[model samples]
Target: MSSPLTLAPATGGQRPRRLLVVLGGALIVATYLFLVTVQPAEIAGGMGSVASLVTLFGFLGGGALLVAGILPMLSTSSLVVMPLGIALNIAIGQIAGSLGMQIYLDAIGTVLVAVLAGPAAGAATGALSNAIWGLFNPFALPFAAGAALIGLLAGLAARYGAFRRVYLAPVAGLVVGAIGGLVAAPVAVFMFGAAGTFGTNAIIAVFRSMGDKLLVAATKQGLLSDSLDKIVVFVVVALIVYALPPRAVRQFPFARTHRVLGGRTGALPAPSPVKAAHGGGSGVA
Candidate 1:
């Protein structure tokens, strides 16, 4: 018995704003790509190895991801990309076994952006920002795909009646995050050097060396505990996104537009008229 929902066409005035937003997003993406691919390799040895050099590149990459997450809040079209980017980066980190510099960068950026904006915007920005960064790293392919999927699923949740009710956002995030984990598990295992003859042994050896005594003890004592930590983190993020205030959420460059129901039909209200130099209407009038 319920009527089918329909979206209204955007008004003419909104076109310029939308165009500017798209252009800005493209520029951000381009700049991020350059930083990820050309800049890092040029400045450092692809991955930062030297102490001071590593720190510098680390700061730069982290700053770029943070900016990407924050910038999208300015426009609705691009706001959701952050979460997608974040989800993708998380998958990549989990899959790689050895968390790279990019993971820290993304984590810091995502947490900061999510705290500032709501979880939805935070998640979107996180996803898109990481996706852009991933373009430069072959290891990121699986994560990027996963991030894209999460973004799409979250958007769908927002569009549906029951899911958009704020309280359900965390549930939405959990479902999406779980799906991301499932998809990334096999890809991660492969990427973690399990693809070749000695890959599994090699990876285990590497883990042994990296983990050392403390890590080994921790792993042996409670693998489930470590996994629970990760799940808790994801759920916390989802809850944060859901609970963020509208005003706070609006601060993000990628903020979603509030859909006003039963407002004036058709287009948005026109801009107020400007007075002429002579006080009366101008030539155009």
Candidate 2:
């Protein structure tokens, strides 16, 4: 894939970005009011706050910014990877919170896309995944920015060769998780009031029982859960990369960049030469 700095094109190659920029500016004013005035009077889980309502509007603004990244990163290859990424997110995401665990397996696919492609593609995978999540449950709308951040950071980590060594994967994940936690904290506090489906919410409840501020409790919970989730995700992706055949893996944009072709490039064995020949050397062919 091209450098993340290599923007493909603006929406309509230009016009939409201009419009979004204007919309985003307006949303910023709303967000300020929400955080400054609205959040203070909130009772946990109560649905009454013009400021918080404005923050929800900010989620749309955040989504627009996230989507804006996709246009420049969008390509046929990214489109190809995106469906699989979303599927991975949906499928593994379901595996989460079973038996009351805090982990979310959702971002495996998003990180996979980021490593194979770049931040823009990864960002698309994340944004689209949450957009789909909103179809199943509207509560996911606020966390879209957090998901996008995860994908973006994973792509940036891969671009810098974090996947080259097995050990470095979690380090990358940690970074992604830390930033993701910060992004998600505000969403959970102002939008959802720290209520959630997993055991992480139990942790929030624990903090709340201790009289912790809602924002502080939510931030702590997000940091613990999101970081742990992403650490597992990065490590899992590393193992998957190790197990994949080089030829099969090479179709991705970051294949060469990720060193998936050799130890110098994190390469692994492919099908035998004869096997490839008999298969007409056509990987997807």
Best by lDDT: 2
**Full-model lDDT, candidate 1:** 0.40
Q: Candidate 2's residue-wise lDDT over 99-211, tens digit each?
A: 55457788899998888878777876887788888898788877776687788789888888788888899998888997788777777777766678767778988988999
Minimum summed lDDT over a 10-residue window in model 1 is located at 258-267
Writing each residue's lDDT as its tens digit, candidate 1 over 86-158 gives 5554654565446432112234335334433344444445445545666766455334433433444444444
Worst 10 residues of 2 by lDDT: 260-269
Q: After superposition, which runs of candidate 2 have C-alpha atoms over 4 Å from their true positions?
A: 1-48, 95-102, 258-285
Reference-based lDDT, residue 206, model 1: 60
Tell me the TM-score of each prediction against the true structure: 0.35, 0.76
Model 1, backbone clash pairs (residues 3+ apart or across chains), number:
31
Q: What lDDT does candidate 1 reach at residue 24?
A: 34
